[model samples]
Target: MKINGEVTTGLGKAAYFLSQEFYSLEFERNLGFVPFPGTLNVVVSDDYLDEINEIKNNCQNLIKPDEGFGAVKYIPAKLCDEINGAIVFPAKTTHEENYLEFIAENKLRDQMNLKDGDIVSLEF
Candidate 1:
């Protein structure tokens, strides 16, 4: 999915230079039916990396591997991270079956216009 987030850098070769390189990261697991990046989606702009980190934290806390079936599970996190975080857009709809289907078809992640450390609530 296209993450409308940041490219963390200052006006210099360090920032742009870094962008041209590759890196590896750890995935905590699925927070829900939504898929995490199999590979990095192009870093859009640090314009919103803060938001990405926020959602990542929230989603990581909420997700657990299902005991028998291995589906995603829900566990909530305390939301007082000090950094201002934005909730994902169409929050309520993410839980709806129809919306889930849409998410599956489109392949999605938190669409919240957030900063690094935001929360995206998925109602069960």
Candidate 2:
């Protein structure tokens, strides 16, 4: 499956959670790499809401967080048909339904030269 969306800025909160030792260890164990200390936020159009929900419902790769943190589920995905990454869905998030969070081994924005409003594709 594939989904496309425009790059957007996040609430600047993901880095703290992502940088935690417990989460980093879990990511390394499950995904083979510790994610970059942040996430790439993508805002998909309403047209894909159903598909997004479907993906979230079917996702099986779950990362259980330590105390005081929420769990997250992810599915391996490719960013812009090139970079390796995953689409992560947090069990608790302030984001709306249309927002998608992506994590990779490196900073995706820098690696892809992406800026807010840039359109990108994710292939699973």
RMSD of every prediction:
15.8, 0.9
Residue 76 of model 1, lDDT score: 25
Q: Residue 59 of candidate 2: its Cα lDDT?
A: 84
Question: Against the hidden reference, what TM-scores do the models get?
Answer: 0.22, 0.96
Per-residue lDDT of model 2, residues 10-65, tens digit only: 99899999999988898899888999999999998899988889889988889888
CA lDDT, candidate 1, residue 28: 21
lDDT of each: 0.25, 0.91
**Candidate 2: residue 28 lDDT (0-100):** 91
Number of the top TM-score candidate: 2
Q: For candidate 1, lDDT tens digit of each residue in 1-124?
A: 1233221212222222112212101112222223222211222335555654454446632222223222222232212222121222122222212111111111123333334333333221
lDDT of 1: 0.25
Give the Å error, residue 92, model 1.
27
